[model samples]
Target: MPRQDDAGSESEHGKIPKSTFEIYRAEGDSQFRNKSFLKAIECYTQALEIKPGDQYCLVNRSKCYLNEGNIAKALADAEESLKEDAAFHKGIFQKAEVLYFKGDFENALVFYHRGHKLRPEMEEFRLGIQKAEEAINNSVGDPSVIKLRSDGDLSFFYAAEEKKKPAARSSYQKPKKEDSGPKRAQRNKAPADSKTIKKMLGDLYADREYLEKLLREESAKARKTEHSEKIQDLCIEGLNYLDSRSEFWQQQKPLYSRKKSAMREAAEKDKSSAAKYVIATLEEIDNKQTAGEHEAAIKQATRLLRTVEKWSPEDLQNREEIRANLHSLIGNSQFELERYDQALASHQADQKIGEEHELEESQARSRDNIGRVLAKQGNFSEAIQVWEQRLESSKSLSPMESTWLHHEISRCYLELKEFNKAKELAEKALSYANQMGDNQWLLNTNVLVAQCEVRLKNYASAAGNFDSALEHARIVDNALAIDAINRAIQDVNQKLVEEEKRLEEERQAGEQGEGDAKPDEAAGGEEQQQQQQQQQEQQEPVQQQQQE
Candidate 1:
């Protein structure tokens, strides 16, 4: 210390003014508290230059980087801090925060638990563990609930309070020597302790056994509701404990298969009870569908189908009927979910079963479903053919059913741009709807007619039809239909205005053209006469020259 100063100037090879590491670190802490992340980073960098292995400074700067949305830099700082001190709780927590923000809740939970174990009193670590667990639960139970990265709400995982800094020293402190011996010794230990590993394995086995017992109980139950509930609970528990990497979890695979087989065997042993169970399961699927749980409905229908497939030939008292019902249920659920390809496949399977059994009603229903799918896919020509075939096959139908079929065919024709055909079918459907006095079909048929009229460029007729449709929609108290008809009316009015403007512009252009053409025709006649006189004069000159 050639000249000691208040700012802690040091001289080794040359004298220079330099603040102590504590002062720079304190400045960083102040900036960080004020939310000045860039300035905090600058101060932390200066502190690190003075004391390169300061874990506290590195961890604090990692937090600053995280606040600035620099995830990679934050992770780098956290990793370096952990390298300096492997037991650094703040560094571990920061690493977990980065993982949580990245939507790796499983790994985040691991790191958070590790940090919590090291620092039990830290509220941030505990909160992080809780959040990571919640995220993991959502991902396991319903993946759709997980927020996307672009959802702009990563602050939920970052809601922990900022950590307080340690008390600063009054004087400059020398950098401590690196400790490699202890770190190297610790590195030789196993990643997880033997006791913890054994506990994890034991817990996994216990859960698996419990699930297997539940499945057995479920198969023994005669009540379908109780049995379905038990199976559903087993599925949830299995999902909660499932881990692909664990040997214990992998061992549970055959147990799950055996449980499924047992359930199937029990159902097949009693055909009457099994039929009742199938009906109950179908009712459950329908309830799910009605509740807008389309995904759950689809899963239940698939499971029922699998169970039906496992039934013995003799045990299948109503095998064809049950299979057809399951297929139809799956198709309806998939359709509600807008999974068109899967729905189409299920409907086709149902149709084949119906055809083999010669069930006319089922066949007609399948054809209708197929036509609906085709129309949704914009294959209107094929949809029309299918609907026409259905129409031809059904000779004796209720007035409402026939009206609905005509309406369906008219919709196809409208999509295909066949306005004349659409109008004819729509009018016929309207007549049937009027005879039945059904307001809903009347509204639909009226809209179809309005659409056809718009396509035919009959704006007044289209407007009248839309008005009638709107009145019917209002009478039925269907706000959505009312809005649709209102929009149609507005569109027709817009088209009418455009047409009138176009006609007026054409009339003006024609009048201007006529006025301009009269003068042009007179000038053309005068020019023609002048050209003839000039030609005669030239010919007379030639004749005189010849006579001479």
Candidate 2:
């Protein structure tokens, strides 16, 4: 075995001491533990090169790719591992995990079931099956009632092999010693037993029926656990992911429909084919924005604004919304460039269009943009006022949006040294985040609350809140957040020590001052008594002389 210290090292020959596959695998494992996923992938790749078709290295590399957000490569490696041995439990599980993350619950469930059959003792496979089932149900009601593949394959439970074996040759053609092995015998009997197949199908049908019934019940909606709702959201996310994965979905739907409608109307009026040019120009502007070419985006948006202004209301029914959006886009690009004054002017114009059109959604969005620009300009009081107005009228705001509003307002309060108000708003933001089940927002609100506590001199509470924020940050795998939280924890601890030391010094000074004052008071009383006796003696002598 390679020692931990030997990871990523080489001998005089520019190779590990043993130069064996295990050495490379061990180094990969070490790098994985350190969360250096890219480096781990490099090490695992080298290991696989040394030991081609090694199941362990392939699966490990797939996991590294998954962690690095390369789901396609991860799935490829996972399937490759399975090609080496279809019955490999780890490979099956890895493939299921990748599919699950990719939002392919049906395929994922099949692999999960396969892994469970191969390794009945593994709880992960069971959990995977349950999660995939829930996701499937959430997206489409009871699976049993849903149409299965036209072929005999029940893909949800057991995926058919992509390639089928050739039919058996005439009985006398293939008599050989190699064909007499147990593996060969198993392959010969690959089809499930009739009774077993029937039983599995019955179970799947029953599961589907139960899901259909549950979905039909009015009480079912009320009874859905928070986890189920989260699964439903995941289902929607998977759909969106699939849509984005396809080129037509990415390009044809959102932009083309509205642009084409307006362009058709405009072309009919002008008898010209300027629609394509306008569409291409708009796409170029968007591309520039996405590429972080803020200046170019702003210039393009300004030119587009002039063209849009020339279009009459007859050409575009939603002309105001379009013009407002262009202004908003320019504002956003300006904001990105830290041109707060120009951004503010653009967003104000967007708000004006919203007011003229009575578009509440656009108005709310414009107010938000304006507030953000104001905040960036250090006009936090103005920002807070704008955000508060926006919040008051936002009946349709999502929990995430509500959380943002509360959190940003609290941040403004914190900057103004209004600790109590800041803490109150932060707590409200936390509640909203909890309702949304958003760990990223949870992390943000928790940190905001901790900051409020720190400003209020609640160091202990701040420390506790910071610790909670750190846990949220870790769950989200935000390295920057984790590092910032760690530093915040350190700062809170330091403040706590300083506070204790300051209080102790003040207490000791108070005690010393009291002790000195007691002695001075007693000596002053003795001096007063002595002065009285001397005055009385002098008065008696004068009285006696007058009597004589």
Candidate 3:
């Protein structure tokens, strides 16, 4: 619910300067705190104009308007702020507050509960709900007489009312010893004095024995099922006492050690049950991811992994399997966030664990993930090598799996411009896909084969392969695949036409050159005869000149 500006800088004409906006917003806050509602509204309006859609300004203005008795404006501002961010608890609370003052207790209660659901720790929402419910109940008896009060007046009234309330006695006071029967005295002594309680929870934590004894006695007096509950209560009490004392006591190491030991014992006792808990937690994490709550999913998965790591090696039923799965889950979450290095590290850890445990399927999956991450990083060579090694090592691969690996390898080859290799692998993949009757794989392999043909300049063959791919895509009802195939077909057709046009132009240029060469040869022979006759005439002229 924290307010944040949308990405990108606003144009000069679209927004006031950031510094100016901040100044106005600050002035608005000052006026709001001073109860100058009208001035506050003006300042907030200026801020909003400077940076329109500012959630904080909207919420503040709503509060000002509500305080100034302008219910319509208050409601409008509150609703607008919520429309900008429905999950903003402040806006939800503001809307609820406005409704409460407007005497619309029913609607107020609804938004109050919504705000509470969003942020359970906010005391204002709890108080608001209490007040709203009270108003609703009171209105049932005297609907017309129910009056509304501003938040400021209400706050002052509550303060005055609190001062009028009586204070309770101190915890330090002790009861005086009284003359009573032996049985009554014994009952009074059972609840230990403060000194005894302090001594019992002090230094060596020596009172642990006394606490356990009490638990045992309590269990003996209760039903069998209640024994565990008694024990849990005793442990909680002891831990709480230790925590309280540690704040003032110098020696906290023992307290911390005790807490740690308690946690470890509980974890060891529930190791078997941990699997079901872990499975449920993992499913929740997956749900978060599917809901696009990536950040929350990452945090939950991380905490779960840490908790799992706390279990001793001997306590875990399937240690390596749990570790591998958790690491893979973390890697997937990280990958979604585009944190490639962290994802690679996580996948590698999973792969190492799988290899150490001799879990072939897990190891293969980890390797596949590693390859995928590598490919995403544009490390095609490494990705191809990893996948190829996996394919070679996997002797028991199903036809579909083999086809997938072939398709992956061919894709890498295509990226590397090794068209012939790509074509070869794609064809093999297509055959396996057809044999396995996997329409999706068949469509993908066909597209890959067509791509390779295009890279090799076999336009007609590429177009035909794409046509087959398009047909398969149609059968599968994959609109994206159909669209991609159609576009590929158009591209191939365009390339074919361009190629034919280029060839025809080259052929015409060759024919024209041949004709020009024949004419030049004939002209050359005529020019040589004329030059010889001219040379004879020049020799005669030279002789006549010499005689003269």
Predicted model with the maximum TM-score: 2
lDDT over C-alpha atoms for residue 243 of model 2: 29
How much lDDT does candidate 3 score?
A: 0.65
What lDDT does candidate 1 reach at residue 424?
A: 94
Winner by lDDT: 2
Question: lDDT of all the models against the reference?
Answer: 0.65, 0.67, 0.65
Model 2: lDDT equals: 0.67
| Candidate 1 per-residue C-alpha lDDT over 76-124 given as tens digits, one digit per residue, 9 for 90 to 100 | 7877777746678877887787666544555667778888889899766
State the TM-score for model 1: 0.43
Writing each residue's lDDT as its tens digit, candidate 3 over 123-147 gives: 6777666656544432111121111
lDDT: which is higher, 1 or 3? 3
Q: Give a tens-digit lDDT track for model 2, residues 1-548.
A: 34466555766777543456887899899999887999999888877767777889889998888767566668778887877478989988998887776656667778888899889998677767765665543231222221112221111112223333233232213457777632210101111122222222333434434433443452357677756655544443333333222321111112112123342344345533344555566677765654345677889889988987998866554567668778888987787666789999999998999899887656877898888888778888999999999988877776757887898788777667687998999999999978866565676678778777776778899889889988877765545456656766777788788889999999999999999999999999999999999999999989999999
Error of 3 at 503 (Å): 2.7
Screening candidate 2 with a backbone cut-off below 3 angstroms (N, C-alpha, C), the clashing residue pairs are: 144-208
